[model samples]
Target chain A: MSYCVNCGVELEQSLGQCPLCNTPVINPREAVCNKSPFPEEKGQVEVVKRKDMSILLTTVMVSTSIVCGLLNVLVYSSRPWSLAVIGACILLWVILIPIAIYTRLSVYTSVLLDGLGTVIYLYMLTFLSESSQWFWGIGMPIAVLVTLVTEFLVVCFQMLPRSFLTNTLYSFTSLAALNIGMEILIDRYLQGTVQLGWSTIVLTVCIIVNITIITLLSRKRLRNAVRKRLHF
Target chain B: MAKREKPIPRKDWYQLDLSAIVYPTLHRHDFAPVYRQSVLLTEVVDPELLQRAVDLTMPRFPTYKVAMRKGLFWRYLEPNDRPGPFVQPDIKNPCQPMYFKGNNRYLIRFYYYRNRISLEAHHSLGDGTGCMCVLQTVTAVYLRLKGYPVETAFSKEQGYFVMNIDKQPDPEELEDAYMKYANAKFCPPRPGEKTYRIRGTKESFYTLNIIDGIMSTSAVLAVAKGYHATITEYLNAVLLYALLKKQESDRRLRLKPVKVAMPVNLRRFFPSKTLRNFITMIYPGVDPRLGEYTFEEIVTQVHNDMRYHINEKFLRGDITTNAATKRHPLIRIVTLFIKDFVIKLFYTRVQDHNSSAGLTNMGALKVPESMKPYIVRFDIYMGQPFSSRTNCAIISYEDTLTINFASSIIEADVERYFFRKLVQDGIHVKIESNREMTLEV
Candidate 1:
């Protein structure tokens, strides 16, 4: 019998390597591998199919929109309230179509598609209301700002070096920044001024907290102290 | 030719034990509380004989034939008349969810491989010891039916390492030992210490990869003696050391203590022989906050902890506290849905966070002298870890100790490191894994 060189114990004749250390056997005389105790066929996992789920979702969205549109035409015969349902159905399709078709889409592509879908849905609402002026002035700007801020936060959080504390700090700071930008956009569009109110306080507090975290992280001693105390 | 008709008998039902109540409530798509015990024989398994064996053995172990049912205040077990799943050829992963989409006839299933007969049991039905006893009975009956001339003098009383077959099962086997023995003295909970969790890419299909390292028991015991520690303590130290090595490579892991939750079989401490869930867990490890600990130091600490914590008094207090919480009058009145929600929440938040990985030592498998030569080895595979992806179970028979490392992750660093350390400590391990060598993690 060959012995495992690493563990200095006798190796079974059937073993290909040292079971404890996984060190490959190197003996010329004992090169024959023994049959494994496990089954020859590898175990196959039964994966739940998502295609059926996607089909169900698509059917529900399409039917609801279609039924609402028909009822609005035949029963009420009033305003085209079905336009809202149709727009929502289109938005849902735009959001879910890519996910259903390509299960492994990158985060960047998903965020972009979601942002574009929201903007198109808002435009649809503006078109139905017969008021295109405010679409460019308020709705477009708000949607664009929200989408851009979301994309920025997603990319930053994913790309930047992360620790638990730093990640929390980054998320809060991004939130505060997005809130300030949204307030500015709203004020400029609605009141024709770049006035900041509650957002200023939020931004100031977030910046102070970010600075404190940055200082603590930069110093090894302080970071260790905080980690030990917080137990994160 | 006319088929004989057997009259259907009235079904029997039983209440869920204190420890078993958590299983049916927390069972989900991903988390299936099932454990498997298998015996390898010299000859291939006969499906027809095995089915007959199961039919004969079911009457002996009454609890194995029941299905879990939801009750108004608590979940209970009801006798199911549906025939147990036939002894099908082993396929699919080891421990798939027992409660399938529409099938919940029985909580245990019997399957046959080339030369292995396995029994997968839901934790609600019984613990590893109970499952092993059932498997042993089945094997014995199978061999007898196969004309092997196996001895059939099985006892009715449940005892450690004894196969109780061919006789009536004792009612004590179904007793809720925890509730019966619980002394409500308000013992404080054990210290809650966060451990260094092993993180890796989980298997894409959520399949478990089991690596069974067959080693000589005497060699391992010799090494354990060299370290002046028991086999369990020695292996726990090795596992902790492996985790520490992984932490050394990945700086992202918190420098918490690398602890392994060692499950203590209560049969050793208590006189009860009930096969239901009756074990408790104890966390033993070295606190990294106290600075780097040598292998010797870690083993010493583990040995001391196991020695102190596995006593009858300490285990009594531990189980009493657990049973007392479940035995609360207010908790008894809560609706089943609310109770399930509360237990699920407590399980994920509090219980799941207590340990990084579990190492269950099933000790040894004993059989009648006549059937010993027909058997090759015994193995135990604990279900996938609740929170972590990897957990370990050990079963020894004769001179061979089969340590099965079951992981849902694609990484083998922990297993590799642990095995290599054992080799370095002068123990030879013959490694066998289901993973292809080219795809080694």
Candidate 2:
């Protein structure tokens, strides 16, 4: 018999490491046997593969798009409504391809892929509609702005130290900023002027909420009171 | 000469009891509402004989052979024709959701490894007491099949009392005792305080670490007697005390209530032999926000609470409140899908927040005297805790009381602290784990 150097508990000859501390037994006389007291097969669980799930999802999406495209062309035979189905297929591919292929892709890479996919899918829709002018003027700017704001918020959430109140504050502030940017883009595109309308009211309320949260966080008594009231 | 064989009759389906309704609805992929009970024998298990025993014993447990099906108003249990899953050498974790769609399988499974014969049953079929009855009967049948001179006279029934296998199964065994006994009065729900939950890095691959601490029943009984407490009360105090010590090291958890949900066997209080989940939970512990409490104080509080609340009247009132809610006209009219959604929401939002850990003591296991020589001991392992990281169960057979701690987390601090406390109090504990750690290193 050997003993764990760290925990000082007796170790069985079959166990190479201490069951409690994982300290390797150093005794040369007692050779560790590979067999375990419990069956080896029982220790493992059959975890469902994410890749398999992704493949199944891809199959379903492709099959639906194909069937719809075929029905549109064969049954109607007037307009190329199949193009709309094809555009949807492109969007689905863009959203699901990265998730399916690269399971361990970084968060930043995933967000960037998603943004690129959205832009490409919108471009496909514009090309099919023969509305490149509107796409360049309206759709591209909105999609770019939305993607940038989303990526920024995702980065903030991933990198920043987070608590319930702080997370809520950050999300509200980001949402308010995104709303303001979207309104400015929409106003400039629609009327050739950059003026805010309902966004200012939302922004003001968001600012007040953030300020209240900041105050509560800074004051220990107020923070405890809020926590108690919210039951967080 | 030609002989004619009798055609076997089809079995009829039965409706799920009121207490069993929540189990099927709340069961999810990660959390399967199943529990396991095992009996250790002196000799290694024979797979073929065990299968034969299961085949013979399945008919005896009529309620247990049913499969769950969704009806318009509620989920019901249908009698399944397919045989129970073969007594395989256990190759997967215990109680890992035996129920699946399109499998034509029953809710219970039998597995044997070396000297251990384990039965994992979905809680929807029956409670621990009911499962124990099936296990004891199966063991008796297996011993008899093995040509051991075992008496086949004891009747195998649903309830824990009366181990006689000669009598026919009583129809009362399948009765919804909760509905039958509950007085139709809606009592207001009691408010519950949140308890401190043990947090740790969950074990990879969703594996549970089960550590069985086998000790002498006399030693534990002596300690409990000294404190003027019952075994359950003493064990609850020790578990709480362990949690308290762990909580002290973490400043954030120091003020939380260290409550343990004790499952009270309703059969002891009510005169019912039904095998369904006839149990209620009683949360007993110390509120750490009040102040630091000694071990003695904790025991006294637990003992007092148990003595006061474990009576027939109190349990009847608790069941009545539950039954009244289920029997409410509006609730009964609601479709099963909506009811399932509400139950799932209630389970997570309300019930999960109330208790930190659960302790279920199946108490002592009994077997026919003739079959006792082949059996070494028995163990009861509650599946991983619903919301907490750890749960404990205890069952004593003969002189040995085995305390099984099943945890989803990697840290064994609570078990270590608990067993060490027992050791300090002059009780010897022999530890046996599933040995998952050996593979890790």
The CAPRI-style docking tier of model 1 reads: incorrect
Worst 10 contiguous positions by lDDT, candidate 1 chain B = B1-10
Give a tens-digit lDDT track for model 2, residues B226-314: 99998889999999998888788666823788888888888887788887778888888888889879999999999998888888878
Enumerate the candidates' DockQ scores in order: 0.15, 0.21
Model 1 Cα lDDT, one tens digit per residue, A1-232: 6775765645555566654455666788767465666655544434445687788888988899999989989997677778778878878886886667467787777778877878787777774676777878888787777778778778777898878877878787778978898898888888999989989999998988899988998999999998899872
What is the total number of backbone clashes in candidate 2?
6
In model 1, the runs with Cα more than 4 Å from the true position are: A50-60, A86-132, A191-205, A225-232, B1-35, B47-112, B119-126, B141-155, B158-183, B194-260, B268-274, B284-307, B323-358, B368-373, B383-392, B398-441
Cα error, candidate 2, residue A133 (Å)? 3.2
